[model samples]
Target: MKTIKVSVVTPDGPVYESDVEMISTKAQSGELGILPGHIPMVAPLQIGSVRLKNGGNTEFVAVTGGLLEVRPDQVTILAQAAETAEHIDLERALKAKERAEHRLNEVKQSNVDFKRAELALKRAINRINVQKRDF
Candidate 1:
């Protein structure tokens, strides 16, 4: 089977690099699935899981809003932050979720940044869902 080189990178560094038969991720526009010979293009990604399928196994990566560049033979994700399922700290994600939820509950407070808290909640939930491969 043909495969495409996929790299997931963040400001800190690369989080994942591998050859995958298929790559599936959510874009700001919608969900997208790319194959080895996919057309070259670029898209803005949402905070969600990137699924890389090779053979019978599927690996997951959580990304916090990024830009995805795809070529005929390769795919690159330039993420603000990213982590593979194995590297995601479930406990930390849970704590973050709790904190975000608490912040959201304080929406009445003028000092609370509702949008920031909502984004944090989304990111935490995304990480937890990706870690569980809930997709």
Candidate 2:
């Protein structure tokens, strides 16, 4: 089978680098699935799980917003934050979600940072969802 090099990078470190049969991620428009020879393009990604399939195994990583760039032979994910299902901290994520909720509820000021709070909540929710999914 033809494979494409997929690299998922974050501020902390490189999260994944592998040759995969396919990669799937959530883009701002919708869910996007890519394979070898996919059309070259770029998209802003949303907070969600990025699924990778190689051989018979599958792996997933939660990403909190990013840029996904695709070429004919490679896919590069430059994530604002990334975490694998195995590394997710459920308690911490839950706390972040709560904090974001509070921030969202208290947006009384005209210049409240909704985007930041929204991203935080989305990241926490995405991590929780990724960690709870079946392999």
lDDT of 2 at 122: 78
Give the per-residue lDDT digits (tens) of candidate 2, residues 13-73: 8998999999999899999999899999999998889999999988899988899999998
Which ten residues in a row are the worst by lDDT in model 2? 126-135
Q: What does the lDDT read for residue 102 in candidate 1?
A: 98
lDDT of each candidate versus the true structure = 0.95, 0.89
lDDT of 2 at 135: 28
Residue 45 local lDDT, model 1: 98
State the lDDT of candidate 1 residue by residue for 1-135, as single tens digits: 999999999989999999999999999999999998898999999999999999999999999998999988789999999999999999999999999999999999758999999999999999999988886
Q: Which numbered prediction scores highest in TM-score against the true structure?
A: 1
